[model samples]
Target: MNEQEKLLNARDRFIDSMAKNMSLYGITHSVGRLYGLLYFNEKPMTLDEMKDELGMSKTSMSTAVRQLQELNMVEKVWKKGERKDLYQAADDWYDSFTALFTTSWRTGISLNMSTINRSLKELHNLRDNPETPDEVRASVKLDIEKYQYALDYYDWLNRFVDSLESKEIFNYIPKKE
Candidate 1:
């Protein structure tokens, strides 16, 4: 194959791999494909341009762009003479992965911690009640210990997420020289 053909083939392979792997992060393959397309584009693209290039409906393009925006994966940019909205993919892969990873992990940790805290509170009450059976109190104590351990783990995870956001994790696990 010619050099241009080989380059196109490599680009397509990258895009295909990106589309497939993005499903692990709860994103649709089509949306990941759109992100790959925008990542390789030299200039910001409009909804119409994306639709024409991807052969996707304008509505689908719009939805995909919105999803990307929520994830901080792409951003809308302005062209001084252009009226239509243009969007550029986040070009920094490290920052992009850090944002995505930290945000999702923090959210999950917060939710699980909240539920665990509530359950711990109720379990504590149950254990303290005089009318409760001894066997039941013993079970509640075990549960309380388990929940406390989970809370500690979540707290550690939150700190890890903080390090990721601050880029302090690189201090301990430096990138390739």
Candidate 2:
């Protein structure tokens, strides 16, 4: 194959690799592929352009663009007097990265706290039961202490994240006394 053809092949494989990696994180492969194409292209593309370039169905392209939009990974640009919405990757890819990070962390924190609370409540009930054996109650009390420690750790993590200034985090350097 000619040098140009080899380069194009390599580029396509890289884009596909990105899609696969994104899919591993539970994002749709098509959305990642679309983002790859937009990130590489010099100019914003309309849906038809993207479909033609990716050789995917127009419906797939439409859905991928919408999904990327929802993820804050892409934006619609207006062309003067043009009715079709032109799609472009976000100006700073970090915007997309931060959005994904914050959303996932928020959900994880909530779910973890909920589960810990439920476990602690059940353990508390087990310990408080009048007919419970002494040994069983002691075991339940130990489990409750472990759960409380876990909840305390999670709360510390939540506070740390909440105190961060998202935009400035990357450039921040700690002051030395």
Query: Whose TM-score is greatest here?
Result: 1
Model 1 bad stretches (over 4 Å)? 1-6
Q: Backbone clashes per model, in order?
A: 0, 0
Q: Write down the RMSD of all candidates, one decimal each.
A: 2.2, 3.8
Per-residue lDDT of candidate 2, residues 71-100 (tens digit)? 788899988988888999997666686565
14, model 2: CA deviation in Å? Answer: 2.7
The lDDT values for all models are: 0.90, 0.80
Tell me the spans in candidate 2 whose CA falls farther than 4 Å from its real position.
Answer: 55-57, 160-165, 171-177
Relative to the true structure, candidate 2 reaches a TM of: 0.80
Best by lDDT: 1
